[model samples]
Target chain A: MTTSQNRSAFLSGMLAMLPVTPGIIPFAMISGMAALDAGMSPLTAQLYSVFVFAGASQIAAAQLITSHAEPLVIILTIWIINLRFVMYSASMSSKLPPSSIPKALQAYVMTDQSFAICAGMFDQNQVPYENRAMFYLGSSVIMWLIWQMATGVGIAFGSIIPTSWSLDFGVWLCFIAIMIPGLKDFPAIIAALVGGSLALALHGLPFNLGLVIASVVGIACGYLTEKKLSSNLPVKSDNDAKERFQ
Target chain B: MSLPTLWFVILAGSLGTFLARYSFFWLSGRKALPEEWIRILRFVPPAVLAALIVPGVIAPGLETENPLFNPRIIAALIAITIAWKSKNVMATFAFGMGALWLLQYVETLL
Candidate 1:
């Protein structure tokens, strides 16, 4: 891509993240409150966002850590929460900058919102590879900065945020924002139904093992169905599921 | 709540988060993930989300489990239905949170 084209792609990606800012505000606020509720420091909470940007995984890890859950258990839960990122990463790797873009930069921008916008750009075939990375970088920097700021807002004001107000609902709203856009196929539909049912049925399973099991079973069902039903199943790419998400 | 404990949580949480994010990258470099494993990753989001929501929307307390009639869950169902039918994020949030608030209030009255 030309230099100006790269700059425009980056600018457009930043613009895309602007819309998601409104959704993330409350979620991050609640997370800050959660940190206080867990008796954690603001620095620690902010650090969680800085080092580990996955909001759900951060919450899951925080809850477990406060409860004195085993290290292994906490690790497992975070892994499960972030498994989706593998899909994101794998999808984008082939379309990224060839060499000058460092692995760390590639890894950092592999977030849900950034990946989505980047993938969307790619899908539309509007930008070249070099520019795609720049776009993702621009998008992710905005998201990451906003997330930290949101967490800061949460920490500074989280305790005062009223439970009665149900600001916590924003977390669910954010998930919906993430999920709704991808409900595009039959297998995804069936997997969601079946997987959701199994999860509910197995809700009482300890240490959130039910979550892991349900996810496994659900993915298995979807994968098998796709393989059996789709006459032209695409060959498995070099990247695994986790790679795709990352 | 102790200092050591809090530190433990932070350390554990951070380490856990880092490992989870970095693990697949390291593993994928060494060997190819089996095709069977790739197939199973598809259903994870639905399953994990269900696991997260079902417990909270059901009992939110100790003792016996509740069923479909459970008000919190029923309320969530309403929200999910809105989400499915409308695919409107703001609408789904409004309905789901609205239902949860209403249910909680009603339960208090009873």
Candidate 2:
């Protein structure tokens, strides 16, 4: 890619991220409050925002801590909640500048928003793979700064946001926004039903271990069934031409 | 504030991030992610979500001393329906929260 193109892509990605900036602050603040409510100190909460910017997983982990769930269970839940990132990171690894950026920096900046913006461009195949990492880093740095400030605000005013209002629902809304759009096929439908039912059935299990089991089972069912099910769904072959196969 | 809990979140976050970030790099070099794994990963969000939502909606105040018909659940359902039909976040939040407050107001009437 030419230097001009690189600058253009970077500029576009950053611009696309601007609209989501206003939401990030409150989201992090709510998460910070969750950390505090779960007995996490202010410093710990801020550090969590700085390091682990995965918002949903942080709340899930904090909830487990408040319940005094087993440490392993808490860890396992965090892992499960974050498992999707495995796909994101893998997709991005090839796109990164393999030598200039160290593994540590890549790990830190790997996040949902970063991955989404990067992947959207990647799917378009406009930007070369080598420059994708810088695009991700640029966007992630901005998000990270927003999150840190939001978390600090939440910690500073942990007293104000009335628990009764349940601002935490924003996280749920965000997750739903992310999840619902992806449910565009039969496998996803089956996965959601089967996974949700299994989770409900297993809720009595200690330490929220049931969540892990249910998610795995749901994904397994979805995977095994998608081929037979999605065979009938419309599919397009290439971006150059719009031809649908049924 | 405890040392153990503090260390655990940090260690888990760092290790989790590293493992997730690297998993693709290592795997993509050899072969495409098996169709099964890809399909499986697709369900993670729903599964995690169900795990999160069902408890809140169906069994709110499970740990609270008293459990009853929760207005929050009612509001959530309404919100979800709005979210589904419209796919609007602001509408979902407004209606869901509005229902909760509205229901709470009705409860006082009875």
Candidate 3:
């Protein structure tokens, strides 16, 4: 594709991702504020946001630190929360064509929001396969910028925001919005139900270890459900032009 | 929380996360995973998201003396409906927060 075409594909990616930006704003701000509340210096909080770059995991780590959990425990908890990234990374590998960009840089920028958005675009053929990586960059790079800016603002001014406002709850609301619509197939629905139920049952586990066990059990349920039950939902043949963004 | 420990958490956590994100790409020379792996990975987002969100929404109710009814759970139910109907982020967020605040107000009156 021409450079002009590449530019537009990138722009389309950014536009598609625009609607989802609001979801992360609360999350980034909350994560930033949580770090500060946990007694990390501004520099440390900012650096944590930048380097860790995963909102849920960053917040989880900060909470662990506050309880004076062992450093190894903190790291492992972060890994467990982020374990889905292994799936995301594997899935993303297929979507992204071979590129000149270093593998490390690509991995660092791969986020749940950008990955979900771009994957939907690719599946719908909204953008050319040739430009998949470019579209990904368009979606991811902007997300990274926004997350950092929001985190910095959160660190700088998040203290002023009243806790009673319950802004942190918005993150869960965002995830719900993204997740429910994707419950198209039987396996997907089963996965969600099993995962949700297991999580609640295991809620009292220490260090959020319940999440780890629940996710594994949930995914297994989904896989087994798919194998046992053929999808009854009729397959659509690219007729619906719904732009399933974030 | 010590200087050394703090730095270790950040640096080591970042490295571990990077590995999680990079695991597949670093291992695979091909463009995609085997079809079997793809089938399994498809559920990753759905399952993981469910794991993350469900417990979070219920926690407010769980924490209170009454596990059956709470502002957060009610608000989330409203948000779930909004999300299913419109699939719009702003709509869900707005309605969810609105419901929560309204319920909290009613609770105050009660």
Which candidate leads the pack in lDDT? 3
Q: Which candidate is the best by DockQ?
A: 3
Residue B93 in model 2: lDDT:
58
- TM-score of chain A, model number 3: 0.78
- Model 1, span A117-224: residue lDDT tens: 567667677776557777777888787778778889988987776788665655655455445444456676666666667777776677656666776777777667
Give chain B TM-scores in order: 0.63, 0.76, 0.75
Among residues 3 or more apart in sequence or in different chains, the pairs in candidate 3 whose N, CA or C atoms overlap within 3 Å are: none
Rank order (by lDDT, best first) = 3, 2, 1
Candidate 1 chain B has its poorest 10 consecutive residues by lDDT at B59-68
Tens digit per residue, CA lDDT, model 1, B1-110: 56766565556655554444444444534554445555555456655655555544453543553442355566666877776676555677778778878877876676
What's the i-RMS for candidate 2 in angstroms?
Answer: 4.8
Residue-level lDDT of model 3, residues A1-246, one tens digit each, is: 688978887787787778789877867887898799778999999999999999877876786688676678688767766766776777677677887667787889988778777777787787778888778888888999999999999999988888888876776786787677767778878988998999889878876777678878888998788878864433221111123343
Provide the lDDT at A195 for model 1: 63
TM-score of chain A of each: 0.83, 0.83, 0.78
Please list all clashing residue pairs in model 2, or write none if there are none.
Answer: A90-B24
lDDT of 1 at B7: 60
Provide the DockQ value for model 1.
Answer: 0.36
Residue A103 lDDT, candidate 2, scale 0-100: 65
Candidate 3 Cα outliers beyond 4 Å, as residue runs: A1-13, A64-73, A95-98, A122-132, A231-246
Return the candidate ranking by DockQ, descending.
3, 2, 1
